[model samples]
Target: MSALVNMAAEVPENPLVPPIPELVIGLVAFFIVFGFLAKKLLPNINNVLDQRREQIEGGIEKAEALQAEAQQVLEDYRSQLADARHEAARLRQEAQEQGATLIAEMRAEGQRQREEIIAAGHAQIEADRKQAAQSLRQDVGKLATELAGKLVGESLEDHARQSRTIDRFLDELEAKAASDSTKAEAGR
Candidate 1:
């Protein structure tokens, strides 16, 4: 305790004030370090900062170019879509026209076929009517020949005589039938 007290009494009166030589040495050392940092480290730091700035600008430029390319691609896609829609509409219209043409052709063909069928039917009916008329004439002639043979006591076996008799009888029958039809109409 006595030694601590003696040491305290021997201590400098102004402890906050350093000696002049020490202050000068400290100032010299600080200047040397500051000068070295300013000459060497400061330039390296500035170069690194400039490189980083260039990299950031280049990245921004690349991003802008990519955005422009994407915009162009989107525009092209939209144009193609519009073209496709127009083509689809054109194809649909063409198909409708073709369908209408096909329907018209089918109707024409059907009409032609119907006309041909009607003509064929008329021809068939005429042929059938002629055949029936010929058959009725033959039947009436045969009946008349049999009745005449019974009445006159003779066989009508001669072809020419029989044909003549049948024609004469059919002509008289047609005349009588015509007169009868006229009388019936007058009565009506």
Candidate 2:
């Protein structure tokens, strides 16, 4: 260690190397370059990096807001769709019930109308039978009076003769009516 130290001290500095004036010029050039880079290039680079960071953050916030709004809209639409379906179901049920009730009422009305028509027809037949019986009785009575006048050799147009003839005719008519009723019963 002592020999290495003495040899380093005895060695003379090389004159061929850079002199003090050259060294000073080199130092000055290096300081000027470093100052220019710090003032212009470094500030421009920092500004560009800051702008890029701000743009990225803003884009992330906008995406989150759009996602939230879309979720809200989707929920609202779903609720509305459910409400519409429920309303449609209610309307369908109501329409079906109304149709059933109307059908029942129509059936009842038709039955009533049919019964009324049958009753009217029966009443008309009864009235026509009574009218025909009265007309037949009048014609039969006139013929009986004529026949009695011929058979008895008397004027049956007189009241006493007419009464006797009608009495005989009624007795024969009652006997015939009884016989016809018995025949109808046996047929049934």
Best model number under lDDT: 1
Q: In candidate 2, what are the lDDT values of residues 88-169, reduced to their tens digit?
A: 9999999999999999999999999999999999999999998988787777878888887889888776767676777678
Task: Provide the TM-score for each candidate, comma-separated.
Answer: 0.72, 0.66
- Runs off by more than 4 Å, candidate 1: 1-34, 172-188
Evaluated against the true structure, the overall lDDT of model 1 is: 0.96
> In candidate 2, which residue pairs get closer than 3 Å at backbone N, Cα or C atoms, i.e. clash?
none
- Stretches off by above 4 angstroms in model 2 are 1-45, 158-175
lDDT of 1 at 86: 100
Deviation of model 2 at 85, angstroms: 1.5
The CA lDDT at 119 in model 1 is: 100
lDDT of 1 at 103: 100
